[model samples]
Target: MERTAPRPPPAVDPLRYRWVILGVATFTQAATAFFVQGIGAMGVHLQRDLDISTAQLGLLLSAAQFAPLLGFLVAGELLDRYNERWIVGTGATVVAAGLLLGSTAPGYASLLLVLLLVGAGYSTIQPGGTKSVASWFDPSRRGFAMGIRQAGLPLGAALSSAALPFLAGATSWRATLLAGGLVALLGAAVFMVFYRRPPHVTVPEDGPHLSLGAQLAARFGMVREPSMRKVLLSGLSLISVQCGVGILTVLYLYEKASLEAGAATLVLVASLGAGVAGRIVLAAWSDRVASRYTCVMTCMIAVIAGMAVLMTPLGREPVPASLTFVWLGFFGLGWYGPWLAYLTESAPPGKVGFALGMVMAVNQIAIVLVPPTLGLLKDLTGSYTPAWAVLTALTLATLAATAPAVAAVVSRQGLRRRPPYS
Candidate 1:
């Protein structure tokens, strides 16, 4: 055989490589979150198989969120100290292990325990992925990039909602869990093998290293800034609405709107699909706007409008109700893109991880509390209307509280004559 020269590997463009980073980050997010996000979709199946009530089903979803309450703080510190590749990959691995173990659980209690384990793993993913994408992209394109990355959430939920329920119906809920684990494992493998820090960036070693305690204290101190307060407030309120939509959508449609179970789940899937689109569109819009916060506020206004519509008699009509929920899904879930972009841009230099963790940790309070509270409210009232009303009131309150601060921030930015990200 004639000797032939080997072909050199094709050169990867440094500028275009960030898209790869975005793809990996997004896939990792969706993969790791598959099972947890699908729990709501499995609610009807879980209640039947596990003999649990709606409140208990809500608890099941809440179980996975509980550990992240404290885990985000620790994960935040680790992200600041270490590389995101390992941080996010390990977290996804933990999620895989948790879900795989969960497939063997005999009852609701055991499943909750397993989900708690999953939550511990998931705590690292949100902030770590946010930091990774933010590091790869600059201010001008950052909002759109962050939006695309964040869209993985609804994308995951949408896929799971469509597939998991059918899997549960055909085989068992356990099979659905097993599938989620396998997907998450794949996500971990891909991210670990492929992800890299931006090559040109270097960590500054000039500053004196603060002890963990001092660093934590400094992170907590960020809460005092007016901008940070707005982030916290919006995160808390909007997350509650998001969780409400996830936990209650199918149930409300099936029970109150008198839709068939399958039809209700399809609506849930459609709503999540809308959310996926909303995140991308709103985020791209944020990049051109003077303030990313403005985009966030626009989402809140749209959600409020949707909630108001849901409170009326027309909300019971299948077409009108489904349309309203889809509308809510758009702004309610879409808000995170611009919101996270605003958060990343507002963080103190070299402390983006800490800021992400702090706000997410605070947001966890609502995540942990809202689902069960909404479930319980539905139980008490025998109506989903009150729950929707509560979400509307909460969002309105957040907007009212933050309006002055937003105005102040916008005024300052205008006076400085700088771009929003600057």
Candidate 2:
């Protein structure tokens, strides 16, 4: 027989595109989250420049979140129906424009209006990003991929938290806002240029759009799923803890630890930096253990421990306080990686967008409620002690909530050997 020439590999490997999706998705997430995450670092600046109370400052954070409350569901339906490239890219452009306009706002309410626009744009990014990356990877590797993508939030936060303090110090908060807007625009540009759906994924055909009644029915149907219900309940408590950590850390340090504003922001930077690493590490760990729930539970435990320290006399001492905050950052922000991965895994086939949007919308309820509530607590008591105690309590509550939720999910999965058929 004559020898045959060896066949060459395909011109483009589908596996390779998954990584491109991850890279662009991660960067877009970072850009979208940058200014919002820096709210804690910018706390002192906003307070002095706007002459706002802690409650008012918390409201600024909440303002950016308010529109997203409903926006996620709308974006979710859009993601399922449209190309993510356009949806995510256009949304980011909106973010840049809103932030640019926000920097020029003459008063607090105007700034809040600008941020509400930013939130409207941002509502698409999370579900869109999660849907983008989840489509690219399979179950085995999904946890790790989701971790890297989700880590973008804290990475952006850490970088901005570190730089924004100095940036605001150098010129003005308005200038800082302009720079952030520019960064978001860059992210939009980069994502538009680099991102494409995986080759195997089909683009939906243009057709009659979902009727309002149909869309509402579909959304309600997803919300009624048991796994989703559990995720919603679990995220409510945990997200409250996460949002509390982000909104309160800087103020807690400046007031409670008696640190200078600069020192406190630096501590906030440290917390977010640790969070970046924790997202990656715990996510990778989930890939290894084959259990996202384990990862979430572990984070809840660490958060409880970190919060306990914060309530102690030891947490009031500067060194211990710094370390405890870093610990909180690790678990506080880390929990989302596995949490999202679990959500992605549990979603009904072909409805990843709806699942992500719906779960996060539920999570937004806590995000909207927690920050200002904590700020109000601090304002009323004139101390962070009550606030920290409240956070500790929330974390403990999440611990109680997570265990049965995870068990229910696992039991439903039939992960354990099924009982002998009758």
Candidate 3:
């Protein structure tokens, strides 16, 4: 039997043409990230306009998890087996509908419905975009590509930070939220038209193709492969902390400190600007670092440490809030990129979407659980200390436990898979 020559690699300057596809994907995610993170910026306004308690406000901000929390397992599996363009594009549309609903919503119940819809929409962006990008890029360049891609979150957050406050005043927060939805919807349309996997690549013909349940099983199997778990653990820890801060910090400023809403929101904007810097810098840092695993571990440690500094008397003290936001922005958001890189490297074939979606799922769970628990703590105790302590504990414990989990899995796998007679 004659062997066929290997298919030529796809075009080198993916930039000239492919970048549009990539950019569309990035912008969709950027839209979602901006809206999700900016809920904190809307904190003071939402509370006053709706007559909801702090706990209820927290529920509204955190409520955007319904889709991801419920739909993500399937979403991940779908991205792996199907063409990503439509998967993600549809997700963006779902998010847009939620945002459109939210803009006109009259009360908390309606707000909850819109947020749940939004979360569902946003969930598809990660797995779908990541699966598509991974198919196009090689491992060596994947980190850089993914870093640029992942910066979508920070970029989106920055845009939201800049736009939300101003738009809210001019047209109401409702209008601003709708603006975000429109952005995602636009990206989705662009994606559906332009985005397709490079045609040169081939899937195993005999293996599963686009079977939702089977793909999910494959993803679950991939995650069980110890190295992949390390990546997942790192992601779960980092994103939980990031979302916790993103959802709560602005309210913390107003409720704990005497800062006016305007002052508090500006501080959040500054912090988000710092986050944009942190994402880029840390992404670059991973390129220089010897081990993706170590870089992720180190960043998680730094972030946990940074959160402690933010919990200081600085809130009540005359110390500069800007300085604290800077530190938090660097140390808090910095953990994201390295861990994302680790995940991109470690996730198994056909399961990158699953891994990323799972990481996102953990983040959303944190989003759902953290703010309300914090709100409850405040409701009961009249302080933010308990919420801070809970997150600190969550980060510290996860950071410590992750290393050993990785080690155990690696050791067991090494023992199981070594050559029979080495």
Q: Candidate 3, residues 141-259: lDDT per residue as tens digits? A: 55555667777787676667667867776777688778877876787787787787775655432264658576446556776676776666666566666666765666777766667
Candidate 3: misplaced stretches above 4 Å?
1-12, 15-18, 32-40, 43-55, 101-108, 172-174, 204-218, 251-261, 310-322, 378-386, 404-422
TM-score of each model, in listed order: 0.89, 0.85, 0.80
Ranking by TM-score: 1, 2, 3
Minimal lDDT window, size 10, model 2: 413-422
Q: Which candidate is the best by TM-score?
A: 1
Give the alpha-carbon lDDT of every model.
Answer: 0.86, 0.81, 0.69
How well is each residue in 253-320 modelled by candidate 2, as lDDT tens digits? Answer: 88778889789878878888888888888877777553577788888788878888888888778889
Give lDDT tens digits, candidate 1, residues 48-133: 99999976886787788888888888887788778899999999999999999989988888888999999999999999999999
User: lDDT order of candidates, best first?
Assistant: 1, 2, 3
Off by over 4 Å in 2: 1-11, 43-57, 103-107, 165-172, 203-215, 253-262, 382-385, 408-422
| Candidate 2 colliding pairs | none
1 or 2, which is superior by TM-score? Answer: 1
